[model samples]
Target: MILAAGLGTRLLPLTKKIPKPLLPIIDKTLLQIAIETACKANPNIIVINASYLSGKITEFLGAHDFGVEIKVSVEPDILGTAGGIKAVEKWLSKDDFGVINSDIIATVDWDALKKIHKNSNATATLMLRDNPDPAIYGPLCLNEKGRVIRIVNTKNRDLSGAEPLLMFTGVSMLSPAIFERIPAGRAVEISSEIYSPMVKAGEPLYGYVTQAEWTDAGTMENYHKAVMARFATCKTSIGMTAKSLKYVTIRPPVHIDTGVYIRAGSTIGPNVAIHEGSVIGASVILKNCVVTPRSNVRSGAFLDGEVI
Candidate 1:
């Protein structure tokens, strides 16, 4: 299951037009990448929860067929992370299911994590990371044996080096039993209401850390970082139908979608994604930016680290 219903308030204006799930990562939307990644686990179906601007998500799913089956849990009132999953209890009760946050770009090994979950006999197993500075990222305090004992405060802690902490990677394995604890059709937070108390009650909540490339694209800085990393690896990909004038500098890692018109003398690249039907005027320089679909970029403008 993918939790994609969040309003993405931090990503304002950009998400003002498109939902977070549909945010582009490299050449694919975040929803597509997440679905493609989770499909590697060989699950029978993928369930996504959508709320903000759900029509676009519904339209995308209706038109495109991912290799695996997809079911959307639409929230008329914006059910939160826990509530959204709780509503899908019937679909997930058959077996333990893995949940992924749509805003994050990760390459987690689901098969390996499943084995660890089975071996540890945990009710909920979260994908963790041994980040150097767990202070900035919320910390998941774990015992030597890998059992998560508690969730630290929700702020950037300036703790000393002696206390080791692992950050929650927003991916977790949850058994059907978790549903019984959370009510359906109500907004509820996962960490505060579910995992924290479960850990205190000795319910075998474990943390499994791995060295996967994870980019939490919830904020602009991190989103920019994710774009730069992916562009460095896969480079730029321009749609064949995207029209661009001659002498325009097309830098690597920039993704220009179909129907985009780029005027002459404009430079774009190194972490930029211009969505379909957008018009980029002459002499414009865009770097580390995302131009939403059908948006018009002013002429001779320079936009850096922004979502136009």
Candidate 2:
């Protein structure tokens, strides 16, 4: 189950216009990344649980066709992590399944996670990563056998005895048995409601450690960083035939979509994404911003934040 329903209150103005999952990092949305990653696991069907502004999500899905069958579970009201899972219990009960958050960026090795869970006979296996300061996130303490023994302070300090008090990587594989532990109908956090109980019950909840890069792009600063990181990693440059006019400065790592017109003396990018049909006036400086489709930026303007 892919959780795509959060309100994303932190990313105010940006998310107000577009769902957080739909916000682009480079040219791809977080939802697309999550869907593609889950496709690698070869699940029979992919389920997305959506709340706030679900119409946009539904419209996006309808416009684009993904090869696999996609199912959406709409929530009348916002449901917490565990509640969302409990809501989808009927669909997931048939077999072991994976759960991921839409706002996270990670290359999850679903096959490896499945193998580890099956071999260890664990009810659930959480993907974990080592964080230098676990205080920011709740830390998971594991015993010698790799079973989660305790959840340290919510801040995740006191890591002396814990070899590596890892943070949850926002990815996990769970057997249908997990539903038996979670109560039906109500809001519940996975960490506090489900994980804590399983650990206290001595039920095996294994941690699969990985060094993969992961980021929670839920805040503006983090979201901006994620966009820059993706741009750095992208090998394909934007194909643009439009000549830069006299005295116009063109910086590296900018993606100027087709049919975009830039007037004389315009400074575009060090980091910028200009969508199709955007017209930039002379002497305008656009940096680290995104000009939405067909928008017009007049002359002598300095646009830093995104242009919507």
Cα lDDT tens digits for candidate 2, 1-308: 89999998988776776788897776788899888888889988888988899999988888877798888888879778888888888788999999999998998888899998898888889998886667666788777777888777674457677666788878999999988878777777888888988888998899888988888888777777777678777643454664554467878778777777888888987778877777889899988877655778999999886544
Model 1 agreement with the true structure over 1-308: per-residue lDDT tens digits: 98888898888777888898887766778888888878888999999999999999989889888878888988988877788898888788889899999889899899878987888988889999886666477777788888987677676454555256788899998887788889776788888888878887888899888978888888867776776667767756787443445668877678888888888899997688888889999999999887877899999999988777
Residue 30 in candidate 2, Cα distance off native in Å:
0.7
Best-fitting candidate, measured by TM-score?
1
lDDT of model 1 at residue 114?
93
Off by more than 4 A, model 2 = 155-163, 235-248, 257-264, 275-282, 288-308
What 10-residue stretch in candidate 2 is worst by lDDT? 235-244
